[model samples]
Target: MHSSSRLFPVALVSAELRGDLTEDVYRLKPNNSPDPSVELALTRLGLPGREQRGAPVILVHGSFSNRRFWYSPRAIGLGPYLARAGFDVWIPEMRGHGLSPRNLDYSRNSVAAYARFDLPAIAAFVVEQGGQAPHWIGHSLGGTSLAAALGGGYLAPEQVASVALFGSQVSRDYWALKLPPVVWSGRFLLKRMGVIPGPRLRRGPEDEPIGLALEALRWYGLFGRFGERGNDWWAGLAEVRAPVLAVSAEGDRQDPPWACRKLFEQFGSEVREYLCLGRRQGFSENFGHVEMLVSKAAQREVWPQVLHWLERQALPLQANGAGGAAQGG
Candidate 1:
């Protein structure tokens, strides 16, 4: 394949046909990458032999996870769900995860770097191809990076149609991490360990660099802020103007619903909605962090609602009837 495009120097890595969908994987070279070794992998999924009728959507996975979080080899998961619904679904694997090669300084890769370098490049490529702004859906730490990008001013509001975050949080209190001695000790151990093994831990297939853990701890340290250098991302969240949706699961102890809701409240977007997946919210059952979107219940109850949100910028009537509010975007 003569793969590189004119708008961006993305190289086509592979193409596979999965049932009714055509999957195209592209390698994106970051512009002014913090680590020159970084090259991102974006997998695009669409209907085969037909033009897509819906706008583009980007699915971002969280820490210690990969593209498989949103897709699988058998044409399963949310990426395929959106593709089948006529949405151009694209999934991006963060540096050193999935098809993306590890950076030379992989141990030091952090969310700040991803927000600053990777996401802008991705939005540019998708916009050029889709001929319009794309919607973004992120899970866990991926959502944190998305929020950081919008808060850090790397992504302009007009560049995206909407933003959705699942199982992501920053406001939850960690009293132990607030202490200096504990923070220092934790950081020391993490640096020595280097990386967190995903499979052994049963989190996912990709191992995450220790820098991600260190970054999280530092944010909870005494007087620590969420931004690098002197920037304050918490304060900057008030500057984001794009419509936002934050989804939380009742059983997600890792990122509890309260914390997720608090994070959503920080966003200054005038058009914003908060959703909780649980019996209280009329879901079949309370969802956990990983299964919130991966399970069959989500396929039956949540997926259609996601499509509704992308198309309408508002929650469905039944969602409001149950406890979820509709702040109509």
Candidate 2:
């Protein structure tokens, strides 16, 4: 196969196919409301309609993203595909982004908030709502949160079947969270200097929704650059004790092949897998930082591997929490 020329197939998403966004799908953490009213939005997609009917898989989006970002031309968005595969897909919009309420108290962003508020809230909700510990599939910042949650014990291993990360840097020179305060200060200065667009200015197609693009870029700026070689999720990988799959694009400047290799090595789980997708999968060589949920080529190349990995594990509802009826967020 001409990996460079191969065009991955993407399933078209129909308006009817779109899952309804409702508050009932989520379980918001108490007191944390108004500011971090962190909640996990659950929806039934794919072939099976029952929320608990399919293999439970949560699609944890990258920084500055919402649930809708997954629906792209090149990517079928795991929501629809996993749903079609008889896996109930739960898409969580991190706190301060998407429908999740913002921090009314703080003026600027805080990466730590996601680790403390969003990740836990979402994980607890999944368990409370009667779904099995899901297969956590994340991108960029989302991937980091998953690792932290696992490392910090915010989530238990039995609750998570496995993990799949796309274009995420666990620890490397370009790692985002480790950015020194000095670098952030410079970025703040750049923003003040009008070198960067204001909070709402956009760069993608005008017709396309600006929310995801803006959030993703904002995350990029806030987190700064964490090179491919700096990722270090070994602690979480070995401790979490779940199978993992890490995918990167050949030309992805943000998460080059080296970074993916590091994650694979540190996450020494025997079940772990890695793939270096090429640019022809769509997007440019710089496709390093975006969510595979938006990458059509990645959807075709990597998503199936995730699904297969999960199916091989197959955590039956009987083995998990007793099957329960689906509820609103």
Candidate 3:
């Protein structure tokens, strides 16, 4: 069995996640000694200097993942890459994930809850801690929640400098419209393999049972899968006036490249960028949704594009890409 303790120096004090991916990052928790203070947690690298001009970027991981996913070593992952690219980066641990408090009844939660409770809390916490809004980036469900929270007034327009979304959808109606059988198949396989458990990541006195988070939300095997949608996030997407970047993977089954493209086209931002990572980019033979962040080719080719886009968006009117020392761990 994997050790329950954190393997990294920067990790949250009490956070206990499997050390498979998040071995190098530190976890950020809310200030202690407050009533109802189950605020979201943040795992960060690259502390900001006083001389920094841009707002820090906060990262939100998708369902079934906490801050650790961003630190996976198979690929250079987003946290370190963005840090090296000259931005202060933070990855949030949403409610019931990693070290954050768990819900008494997991059934009482919804995707909207994460947007309303988790994202807003983290955004407020960032401002309170850093005294400024942040450039937010999210993956899959993470992006969906941030978009919804911002649109819903949980996050003010000024609190967010910009947003970057990867492989995410923005509508409740999207489930029936897209998604292949393989997604369902994967869920079934995982369940058959006994991976379905509650949302908490910390192991209990006994070994923690495997759990299904994203696909387990709905009884029909679809509605509750991605997240609370349409109004929750789409409402936020429509209300958001900030600049946005939407990224999609060419052969992704969960949220297809077309979905990301559609989201960018529908957004109100005048300065939006859309990217489609294809097999030609070396993402992989079948680069499924999660592999992009863990593929070396994606680190070499795709990550730089995201970093450059972030720099340009942060500075305004600047459009240039810079190369990084793409080394493997």
Which scores better on lDDT, 1 or 2?
1
lDDT of 3 by residue, 212-283 (tens): 233332423444333344444443455567888877776788888766676666567777676566645333
Q: What is the TM-score of each candidate against the true structure?
A: 0.96, 0.65, 0.67
* Candidate 2: tens digits of C-alpha lDDT, residues 80-190: 676667766677666454555544443333344455456665565556544577788877767766765665555667677788777776444624524557455655554
lDDT (tens digit, per residue) of candidate 1 on 212-252: 88888878777777787867888899888888999999889
Q: Which whole-number lDDT from 0 to 100 does residue 2 have in model 2?
A: 22
Where is model 2 poorest over a 10-residue stretch in terms of lDDT? Answer: 320-329
lDDT for 60 (candidate 1): 92
Candidate 2 at 34: error in angstroms?
12
For candidate 1, the per-residue lDDT at 234 reads 81
TM-score of 2: 0.65
> Lowest summed-lDDT stretch of 10 residues in model 3?
320-329
Ranking of candidates on lDDT, top first: 1, 3, 2
lDDT of each: 0.87, 0.53, 0.58
> lDDT of candidate 2 vs native?
0.53
